[model samples]
Target: MKALIIAATAAASLVSTAALAQQAAPQNPGPVIPGVCTYYNARLLAQSSAGQAVETRMQQLAQEVQGELQPYATAIQTEATALQSGGASIPADQLNQRRQALQQRAQEAQQLEATRENELRYTLGTQRQKITEAVSPILTALYQEKGCGLLLDRESVFMMNPAMDLTDVAIQRLNAALPTLTFNRMPVPAQ
Candidate 1:
């Protein structure tokens, strides 16, 4: 994760600094981009989207799985309890059958859980992709239109001038252009 952050910072810094450097920029740059650097809070930016639908959908998926998966728990518990309470008194053949049945049910429950997890990962990936697709262009257009020398996520910066923040501006622009995102529920191809 730290590597990822460093890479992103390096990339954003290169683009903005290179632009200014080409035009006779400073050797030792200031923390703030004096005239053209803009910063934004990532968390706030995420919420600015129409309906915050990606997050909402993710929550819905979790809830749906939770509700459905409860039955698996109940079934496993019942089988285990019956075995623990009476296996010693039962005929050996009957006991063996029950144990086998219990193992089969456990395998099915595990498969259901694995499916739920795959659904979760798929939902998160697609929802984020949808949001990024809609937001990136808008940010780029604003950055170019504003002629910013640099754009940095506010989370990376220690301090900056309040006026230099572009989050609000970006949010307004994004909302106007993409009022809502209607995500596609594409089935993930079997891996």
Candidate 2:
């Protein structure tokens, strides 16, 4: 049994060694195609100065919304405190009515919060679309200048020549084009 265990251990070690060697071997990516290029759109958007500005603005808007909602939150806390502290002295009918009123207020607060969230989402989505639109021309210009006929997202390709990466150049062009974006919370449409 001991001899069998030793053989099994040796076999496992050999298998693992072979697997590691295969993983470490450099893959032979074929020669670059002349008209094909790739760019990481997500990286371009996330790392650009304009994108950072938008994120900062979004955080400011969230803080503003929280400020606007603070009074409602305070009111809810006050009402809950009153109920918890003085419930035994109150008549049962009056207590029920107060509880119902509190529930109603809470529900209204939630609805208002949801509306605010929707507004933020709408604003952010519209802003992102605008950013994409602004980037489109830059991307087109880069592709044309590079003599590229095919543009692929970097995420779509497993491996490519470093020269084919257009992300950094695109970001530079994007920064030159749009330094910062100005936006506000768009009103949620009636639903």
Which candidate number has the best lDDT? Answer: 2
Overall local distance difference test of candidate 1: 0.66
Candidate 2 RMSD to the real structure: 13.8
For candidate 1, list the clashing residue pairs, or say none: none
Residue-level lDDT for 46 in candidate 2: 68
Error of 1 at 19 (Å): 32
User: What is the model-wide C-alpha lDDT for candidate 2?
Assistant: 0.79
Q: Give the TM-score of candidate 1.
A: 0.73
**Tens digit per residue, CA lDDT, model 2, 41-132:** 76665678887677678778877888888899999999999999999999999999999999999999989888887888777778778889
Query: All candidates' TM-scores?
Result: 0.73, 0.77
How accurate locally is residue 33 in candidate 1, as Cα lDDT from 0 to 100? 52
Candidate with top TM-score is 2
